[model samples]
Target: MKKFASLLAVALLALAAVSLGTHSKATAADKLPAQVQKIKDTGVLKVGVKQDVPNFGYYDSKSGKYTGMEVEIAKKIADELGVKVEYTAVTSQTREALLDNGQTDLTIATYTINDERKANYSISNPYYYDQVGFLVNKSDNINSPKDLDGKTIGVAQGSTTKTSLEEYAKSNNLHFKYMQLGSFPELAIALRAFRIDAFSVDKSILTGYVSKNNKILDQGFDTMEYGIAAKKSNDQLTNYINGLLAQWRKDGSLQKIYDKYNLDPADADDE
Candidate 1:
């Protein structure tokens, strides 16, 4: 009878452990929105990120790993969900399709938030602010916006840089010829080859490509907003990210990430 009692107690303890684990998981899921809860339950968060753009979201071949401010942000979000992060490298041209195809649960690809993008997907509140800037060969004597007039500028394909620069040129009474490339490296190569006179993008992004032969112009324009994005049906996920962004912005976590990489986002007039 004592042996039977011992076995029953052991079973009770096992049952208690299972109950506790289930209760804890339920409590965690209850704290998150439906989309976010699904991430927590899945044990992995699939993120779309850029493999270029240096400090923003670059993959380092030397380390065989991804490193950048945006990558860190994605890791942080995965931590909040208690999941491992799986990163898929994306380009400006491929990020949206990855989300639409459900290959990625979120995009932290330095995705610019704009009216058209917001209409198609759920974009969280802006986490970073930057302005359009140009990178040109030092020998070209293209020091400012006016110098780009009638110049063939290389822009990343599917990026908003061309539109922003066009507006700037229109207001300043200048004209530009643009060439679209698939990546920043391609644009840089074109600039080096003299195929394009200038390579234009976000000032912060331009900082990553600066070499002794090329430099970012001191002037910038069109303040752009960068935000995390999810599928059009995932408003819950977007709201969850917005809450984290708000908390991070309040607690200085976001600024700390920038400082870790020695990044200073350029303002409209700040050099």
Candidate 2:
């Protein structure tokens, strides 16, 4: 009886060791890059996106849901990872900080890829492309950048649109005072209230504001390349996203997503 009890204890200890080994192997598969591994382990992907700018990444107040091209992209990534998604609304001023400070795992809020941004953040290959444009009230009769002289235009702070608009104005010998709004929604309100004569932003963003009373200018300007952003030096996360983007580009899945928003597929290609 004593010998049998000792053998049983040894068998139990061996079984326990095997179980721990199995668990370690299971978790080893989830040891992706720190950022991605966190999502895998937590089973949730936190994405930062714009709460305004329809057809891009707008939060529908009526539905309490977000809808747009970038939102679709974010959802697709979450689905691919077999994880649930949580979105945090962000503005131009907050998007970079959110990613840099680890408040969000990724940012897909129509983020533009530029040399300055690339120097500080890891950006995926271009997923969508658009040109700078102006949004003006129909009553303004402002048809061109030349007409913008002496007018106040609203632009999002820390956005490429601000620099692009200023460059265009300088090249055209037109000067306009700029009101640095915090986000697209604020700029829209400022325009409607006559606090600003126009809103300068990307054509994709301006398209969301088009209506009988507002129109996106016919002419497009400097090109803007949209990318998914991660923290700088996060090569594993960046490469993982780039690989997925490459596959989506080849599979027509990316175009289908753009089509769902009634966006032009031509404008949704990698550069």
Candidate 3:
């Protein structure tokens, strides 16, 4: 009996050792493919951006080309890396999916860094700070988010601003109908035509719209910082992008991009 018990103990110890070894090997195998290393090896940077969102990321109508502050910044990063830039238009809902599926290497869209998104993706240092605000007819009585209660709020579909509005409504128990428009241009049209009582988006974006059509709407609110997003496990890519962003901030290239569009450079705070 004593001999059998000793043998059993030895067998258990060996099994445990084998299990641990297997676990360690599996963990090492599960590490994400290094996207930055691959990009560097290939010498091409794939950037995803928005097709619309003036002064930030948008397509020029007259020029029939995509141009915005983020576009220029992305160009600079590509230039510094000495690689060709491949720009792809990405919607808010598809941004994370594209990165995870390896369709794009990085997203330069106006992605707001939040806890929920950070859990699934990596975000670089903030390139711009803007408030969550409303755009209403200049003559409308609505002035703040609180005033939005019981009013229809129009937001661009799949945007962080839309999520923020939903969260605020839930937290405050406010009852407001949220209308998700397909695009920023659609939302602008809806607000102008009174199809929705108000439109909520980034202050800078709303300001850009107002600048172009001053007689119709007014800027109403402010929010938090926005950053570029990459895949969560792509640590190498994340670090490389963060380094580039730091250099841009230090050398004032980022500010110059903001200034080129008449935006306040102070708004581009990493914090």
Candidate 4:
């Protein structure tokens, strides 16, 4: 009877040790930064994504699902963290505000990695590269960036593309007027209606909007690096996401997602 009791005691002690270790791990996780800990505790990763841009991110009304390369990337990150995804629609103007206000943990809305953004928020390494391009009506006969001289171009508000376009014009001694639209859909309509002679933005964003009359100009400008942005204060979460992106790139998962969306993975700058 004493021997049996001794064995039971040892087993109980071993179980207690395991429980303590498990608790310790959980405690450490909870001690992480507020954003990371909240995600762990809530099992939800709130993400901001564009609802209109195709191949990057879009909501299909027919299927009632959001599907695209950026969406896929967001889902992969959530899966890696063992969390559920909750997407919030964001436009170029609203992406930064949503992240700063804690409405979203990550913004994967084809966000450009630029100097101003890096100073304001934590951004992941470029997952994709996009060159600026001009989308013009086929009837407009614009074949080059110089053709945009004295033309009114439309761009999304709160986008770095507008600044880039202006700089490109100034550097080439080409003068043009640019109108800031509220959204991408509006830009497309303006361009089609001749309200704006051209719409300048990332080439990838202009792909799905292309029609027989509207074509993406072959004149490519400087390449812009796109990155996932998080709040500047959430370093832990940003680092975790960066590490996740690194793993995905190495394992070919990122490339597969890009391919599934019909985007060339070769365009991604893993650096």
**How should the candidates be ordered by TM-score, best one leading?**
1, 4, 2, 3
Model 2, TM vs. native: 0.84
Pairs with backbone N, CA or C atoms under 3 Å apart (clashes), candidate 2: none
lDDT of 2 by residue, 1-271 (tens): 9999999999999999999999998787666667677677789888999988889888888999998888888999998788999999998889999998888989999899999999999999999888888889889898976788899989998788878877888888888898997878889889898899989888778878777888887877777888999889776888889989999999999889888888863254322
For model 2, the superposed segments whose C-alpha errors exceed 4 Å read 1-35, 265-271
Q: Give candidate 3's whole-model lDDT.
A: 0.77
Best by lDDT: 1
Per-model TM values vs. the true structure: 0.89, 0.84, 0.77, 0.86
Q: What is the C-alpha lDDT of each candidate?
A: 0.90, 0.86, 0.77, 0.87
Using lDDT as the yardstick, the better of models 1 and 3 is 1
lDDT of 1 at 10: 100
Candidate 1 residue runs with Cα over 4 Å from true position: 1-28, 266-271
Q: Which of candidates 1 and 2 is the stronger one according to lDDT?
A: 1
Q: CA lDDT of 261 in candidate 1?
A: 88
lDDT by residue for model 3 (1-271), tens: 9999999999999999999999997776445246654675678888898887888788777887778888887788777666788888888777778998988888988888888888988888788877677777766666565776899988887887766777777887887898898888888888888889887787777766673332323333335777778788876777777888898889988878888998763344322
Model 2 error, position 112 (Å):
0.9
Q: Rank the candidates by lDDT, best first.
A: 1, 4, 2, 3
lDDT string for model 4 (1-271, tens) is: 9999999999999999999999998887667667677787789999999999989889999998998889988998888778899999999989999999989999999898888889999998888887888899989888888888999989999888878887888899999898999988899999888999998888888887899898888777778888999988888888878888898889988878877877753254321
Pairing residues by index, what is the TM-score of model 4?
Answer: 0.86
Candidate 1 per-residue lDDT, tens place, 45-126, comes to 9999999889988998998899999999999999988899999999999999999999999999878888999999999998
Winner of 1 and 4 under lDDT: 1
